[model samples]
Target: MNTPQKAIALGIGAALIQALMLIAFAWPAANTAPRDLPLAVTGPQAAMVTQKLNQAVPGGFEITRPADEAAARTAIADREVYGAIVTGDGAPRVLVASGASPAVAQQLSAMAQQLSGARPAAVEDVIAADADDPRGAAFGAMVLPLVMAGIAGGVLLSLLVPSVSGRLIGLVGFGVVGGLLSMAIIQGWMSIIPGPYPILAAVAGLVSFAVAGTIVGLATVIGQPGIGLGALTMLLIGNPFSAATTAPEMLPQPWGAIGQFLPPGAAASLLRSVAFFDGAAATQPLMILLAWAALALILLGVGFLTSRGRTPASATTVSAEPVPA
Candidate 1:
């Protein structure tokens, strides 16, 4: 083909790629299962219900049993989990927050059925929100801090750059400032959201720090590879694996299986929990975020230090003494 024709084809291909990505998010990832959704259960015999839930979902979700029925319901209302199971006398009830994503509600409801094996089941939406909220939306558990963190995370990771001499001190300071600022903005947004402020702040800090550290660390290692790596984690793997898109249960086997372990997947469920679950299940997310951030920082520090050591003291030498005047 002629050059002009080839150029036209390449342009078309590029457009097609962008279009596909857009469609991926816009469309329902139907047939996807919950990989590692965190769910709360309440029942007369809590132990039996919790065990049954775990067995029913398998790799799809993590199950938690609150101290009491009220607590489990409150957890769901707060968005601590995707949904909860209330087991009592006549029929089992699935408790979910209205503000949560509808897809999740449905999936959790199905899990209740699977566990019951045709036993009567009912659904109770404890923290029902107004109709204005989007359907199947994640819980207020995530709130503003998480939003801020997400924005900051995306920006920081997207801008990573590598250099032979190591990053400039000014750049490091700038990145830190930027990351913190992102955190602050998210903290501010938390007030407007339904969930409380502390949850937002904590979630935001974790997401922002981990993402930023990831960018910084990757750039220190491979320069250009940082961009691709960030994209792989944040865009490709992160979004799909995230519980934010659909409750893990609704997702088919493969997609749901791995979602919970991935960063975004874990963060989405955890953030929502803090916002909606009344902070019942904040520990797991916090631990994951801390681990990722620490690792990234350590790697970045080592890279910087090693790079400096590799530089010879004679790098700036001026021929010893100017050879003899």
Candidate 2:
């Protein structure tokens, strides 16, 4: 295309990208509401309270009847539910885990007040978020920076490291350093996440490796376009759909579940589990992160083999060339 045409194309492309990004980031927040959010209810009025919730939200909650208040608390601690309601002769008690999701906790508190009508419900936090990030704003803000760091590491490795082995080394090195640095900032300095330093550092490193490795692996296999694809996936799709700022259940269906499978979403969930829930409900997210890291390794292996195959042919072509007299 000519210069003028190129300029016009670039402008249009930029506009389209901006529009897409706005939609991706804004749509979820705009439409945030509980969709099949888990809740446990127990006591004599459990059935009545469940019916009330159903009437109030209409498909908003998936209510489970625990044996009693103790069981309900267990469910919340295990991350099985966002909150629980215990109803009896006295005012009902609402149990919430703000560490799991501050938004959900707030919503539960409001719902309890509404249900109680004249009487105020007692709200208890089963797993409270760190005091430094009571509302989880700082915690939520950390996701983007970690994602950007991973993307940057992957892109730089692809551009600067020509060899597959070298790129692998770079990915590992970045994971270690980047993970430690991130933990130092978010945990040590900021105290946004409450957990042992080593464990949190390890989790941070895993996230970095999973994201960067996937990008590096793609670039190794498919060339430069892979880098763009990886970045777009992490930033546009993964970041927005991650549900890091709120609970996944608060997001629209299918997409909410879908986000949990992505690296950003998995990392966010895993971080919260380890930091506040004592590793409760961490299995799925941990597996997802490992799967991404493993995929990267497999792609790198393919790239290595492909490179090896070309090297012999290249050597043959060079050897067969006529030497200058």
Per-residue lDDT of 3-67 in model 2, one digit per residue for the tens? 99999999999999999999889999899999999999999999999999999999999999999
Task: Give the worst 10-residue stretch by lDDT in candidate 1.
Answer: 138-147
Q: What is the lDDT of candidate 2?
A: 0.92
| lDDT of model 2, residue 88 | 93
lDDT of each: 0.60, 0.92
Per-prediction count of colliding residue pairs? Answer: 24, 0
The residue pairs that clash in candidate 2, if any, are none
Worst 10 residues of 2 by lDDT: 311-320
lDDT of 2 at 142: 92
Error of model 2, residue 248, in angstroms: 0.7
